[model samples]
Target chain A: SQQGEEDPQALSIQEGENATMNCSYKTSINNLQWYRQNSGRGLVHLILIRSNEREKHSGRLRVTLDTSKKSSSLLITASRAADTASYFCATVGFMDMGRRALTFGSGTRLQVQP
Target chain B: DAGITQSPRHKVTETGTPVTLRCHQTENHRYMYWYRQDPGHGLRLIHYSYGVKDTDKGEVSDGYSVSRSKTEDFLLTLESATSSQTSVYFCATQAGGQGETQYFGPGTRLLVL
Candidate 1:
């Protein structure tokens, strides 16, 4: 079962517009990671924000994590058509259990039109 | 793309038949995982292996089983295929322990009819 739930099930935007996706989890986590899955492709790691860190950025991608609220958000500035994909947030809990390795969110489908 | 690869990228099988999917990796990572993806269910772990001859069940392990006879190969087996088991299966590997970044393979598309 998925540990995180993503909001805005689907989004459509122009190439230059910004895209934002939100994820909420139920328990504490060691870190929160974002991944992108292109159509008919495997998942690619994006950015990882530790529980101790409030915000982190990598190029056009920005991620913010709020442990108090148990939520995280990924923001992509100046989105491009290449950015069109399904975005998922995976939560890593404190347990070192391999079975509980990564609980991914339902994901948000973003379509960036050129 | 990681050093991981899943064999038989696409497969179509009949119900009640036994099917096996293979995940091979060149990285020699210690941890390997098997997950199935469906329309509403994002990704659910079916099983994982920490090392050779060492495997464990995941949340959705009811219909599946796994085996790791060697470090670089992990195999997932469906004792009896069903229509509901038709989904894209992904294989992932992490270098170290839990919480480490997982590298995913291209995935295998399985259709059970």
Candidate 2:
């Protein structure tokens, strides 16, 4: 069972357009985070949104968390070709047994066309 | 950068051979983790250590093992590599708390022939 599952496994957009990606999780979480990975490289932390935060913005990236729905969305405004990469959503679940490890979603491959 | 490094960024080994991948961190973080990434499975945890010599199995620890003998170094070994084990392995560390974000090292690409 996956803690976070991303929708639209792949996405494509124009450089100046906006791109939105969604992630849904199954369990109650302490926090949610987003990471970006360029092809064949390590993942870079993008944003972290706690369960108490309804929305967060880092640069042109916006993250929204809906604990009520166990879902979150990431939006990148005015997307650039440099933003092309695989984006992943990870969840740190509320500890039912004091064991909490970050679980990652498969991710969405975003491609920005120039 | 997190001061985390993974050695032998790429490895190609034959089946049934023993291979070890190393992760070294300079941040002195308490938690270190090993994960394998597959095309459709995302990043699945293989093992983790909470402190030196304190290790635990993860969601996908079938044929993998890990050891952390020092605060700065963690090792993952495949006792007998199988073709099924061919995948990208990533190492991560957290500062030890709930909801703390993790930093990842450049992954090691392992191919078991």
Which candidate ranks first by DockQ, i.e. highest? 1
How close is every model to the real structure, measured as TM-score?
0.96, 0.96
After superposition, which runs of candidate 1 have C-alpha atoms over 4 Å from their true positions? A96-100, B97-99
What's the CA error at residue A59 for candidate 1, in Å?
A: 0.8
Model 2 regions more than 4 Å off: A96-100, B97-99
Per-residue accuracy of model 2 over B55-113 as CA lDDT, tens digit each? 99889999999999999999999999999999999999887765377889999999999
* Candidate 1 chain A lDDT trough over 10 residues, lowest sum: A92-101
lDDT value, residue B80 of candidate 2:
100
Q: Is model 1 an incorrect, acceptable, medium or high docking prediction?
A: medium
- Give candidate 2's fnat, 2 decimals: 0.64
